[model samples]
Target: MLNVDGLKNGIVIDHIQAGMGIKIFNYLELDKVNGSVALIMKVSSKKMEKKDIIKIENVVDINFDMLGLMDPNITVNIIEDDKIKEKIKLSLPKKVENLIKCKNPRCITSIEKYIPHKFYLVDEEKSEYRCEYCDEAYKLEF
Candidate 1:
């Protein structure tokens, strides 16, 4: 095992799917942070064969909903005073708006351009999201 410096306060995002770690890193603007940031990819996991972890030092606020869309299985640890303060289990959002553009050609968002793409969760089990304007169904897939 490698020794990692403990952070005073920040976030530790674990359980990221191996290659998708960088995707979330960019999505969350973690790479652009001036504070300490560490991204570990393809680390050993007991539950998962492989996983990725991201550590941000001195970060106070983070958008968890976007993180969930980037990778649904991610685990978040709130670090305080070099200790694990809290553990957050992320879940797919009930609804997503303007995050994903409707791919359908005839979709209202595509035609209107100005109107934001909005979707409502229709099925949590099936991960189905339906567009309010065009009725286009989008499956929430990472």
Candidate 2:
């Protein structure tokens, strides 16, 4: 049995899809930051069959919108004194900039280096976000 200690004060990113924990870890720059972060992968889950988990032993506000865009099913648990103080259910943001790059090569953002890669929520039910510059559609692949 793999045993990991509970966080004293930090955030727990739960309900992550299997194989996505590393993406979230890199996205948050956990490696560069000096803090205790545990990335548990391939855990059995009743709902997902298999899932990943990330426990950060430090209070830091990460980009929730990016999490939502990547995996809207993710749950954020804010811990304090080894207990959950708040539970945050992630939702896709209306607009996300620089988090996701526009893949369209002909898009202005792709041509111009200075412009930020911006996407807008086009279809909430489908979890579709379109590039603001070229209207390129992007959907989260589960």
Candidate 3:
């Protein structure tokens, strides 16, 4: 077995959707970061088919909006001196603006260039969101 050391004074994003790791990584700009960062993607998990785990050492000021877009089930673990100091459990916000561009061409967001794309949660159990203007349906997975 390989030994993966713990992070010191940073964060761990867990419970990410299997293939959305790169999207989250790009959205978070983890590649351009200067600090020590580790992205272990598609790791086997009993709870999930595959999961992505990102460890960033000595970093804060995370982007919440981009995180929400990638995976709503993501959990932020804050480590201090290589010990778990804090945990941030996030819930899917009922409404998200501007983070995602509506795919529906008929959607108001796609039609109107100025109006911010707004989506409201229609089904929390299924993680479904609908456009407020054009009634476009979107299923956002965890």
Clashing residue pair totals per candidate (backbone < 3 A):
0, 0, 0
- Tens-digit per-residue lDDT, 78-103, candidate 2: 99998999999998899999988888
lDDT of 1 by residue, 24-103 (tens): 88877776788989898899999899999989988657778778777778899999888999999987787777887798
What's model 2's TM-score? 0.85
lDDT agreement with native, every candidate: 0.84, 0.91, 0.80
Q: Estimated TM-score per prediction?
A: 0.86, 0.85, 0.78
Candidates ranked by lDDT, best first? 2, 1, 3
The reply for model 2, stretches above 4 Å from the true place, is none
lDDT value, candidate 2, whole model: 0.91
RMSD of each: 1.9, 2.0, 2.6
Worst 10 residues of 1 by lDDT: 59-68
